[model samples]
Target: MTAPRKARSALDLATVVLSLMVGALGIWTILAGPTELLPIHYNAAGQADDWGSRELLGGGLAGLALLTLLLGGGMALAAGRTDDPARRRALRYAQLVVVLSIPLISLLIASASLSGATDISGALPVALMSLVILLIGAFLGRVGPNPFVGVRTPWAYKSRLSWERSNRLAGRLFFVIGLAGLLTAPFAPQPLGLYAIVGAIVLAAVWSGVESWRVWRTDPDRQPF
Candidate 1:
């Protein structure tokens, strides 16, 4: 009995642990992200430079970190009572990644400077991070623990077929987008690479949403959910 109670306590305390981690990332980000004569100073590149020089880093990064924490925690807290096994697993995975990605990303960028990788830029990191997110989304779509990520929409949620179809489409779209962004950066215009990544994500979102709507419309006479 004590063991079960302890386990339940541990599960319930996940949010606290997650929040602390996010907080720490926020602090690191606020520390102005490693200042050195690297190729493209993350602090100077692509409007991240707008953060400007302050001896004490501002709260902007920390605020973003806090926002992610709140959003992730809110999802789990809001749905704690869900009886859906897939949904629970999905939430766990998403929250876990969300908690980890921000700081890891910052560390990667900082290390690039240390390693003399002057060409290291946000483009590569952004593409890589997006790919990671898409991969996680694929897993969630394949074995959903919830309805937050992947090809989420009313119709997709109603029918497993729609859910699978739309998400598979989304998965492919994201992969193509990620690949194009990664491979084209060395040759293509920087903005073009950004456009490709953003466009792919938008296209996937629109396509999945539309498919879900169309599927729902097909069963107008019958309530699918």
Candidate 2:
């Protein structure tokens, strides 16, 4: 059964409000801080090479808040309108991603603000990213058929079994990659460690996509695409 429109709207509003609250906190923190400049851009090596006016932080926070609202609201609306189990589950997963990103956005802004004074190593941001990846990996397998989440492809969408198995394998790969990133952050050079983590992500995504295609081809129930 589909969720009630009123209930779903309320949930979406709450989620957006929560995200705005976090954005407000982030902006407030940036404003109250002594730093005039915040690191807004990073190098491929994970180093914060480009700095910008603190106002940039405020702008970024606002953008993120708006994006969260749009994505979360859209998913909530979809969930409420659809009685299909797969679609609902997928929308829920997309909603979860939006909800989870709010805190990470706040943390990233705070980290950059703090780095202005302490020159904190790139490891901090890398660690935070790894944590996000770990959390996503933890639940990715449970995400149902959706265009917005998981390894979406013609083959995978044609075969439920292919999607499920590919996501399961992806979850394991992502988890291991995130764990490896966390473990490497403290001991390795900043850029190299970040590179390793990036490599892991690329590898996981490629492997899962390829696997999905392979599995779909072998599935007896899969229709010609």
lDDT measured at residue 35 in model 2 versus the true structure, 0 to 100: 57
Q: What would the per-residue lDDT of candidate 2 be over residues 16-69, giving only the tens digit for each residue?
A: 777777678557755774456676766666556777776677667667777777
TM-score of each: 0.58, 0.77
Question: Clashing pairs in model 2?
Answer: none
Please give the RMSD of candidate 1 to the true structure.
Answer: 6.2
- 94-152 in candidate 1: lDDT tens per residue? 55544444444544543453344544335666556555545544444443424445666
Off by over 4 Å in 2: 1-14, 25-35, 85-87, 102-106, 117-123
Query: Which candidate has the top score in TM-score?
Result: 2
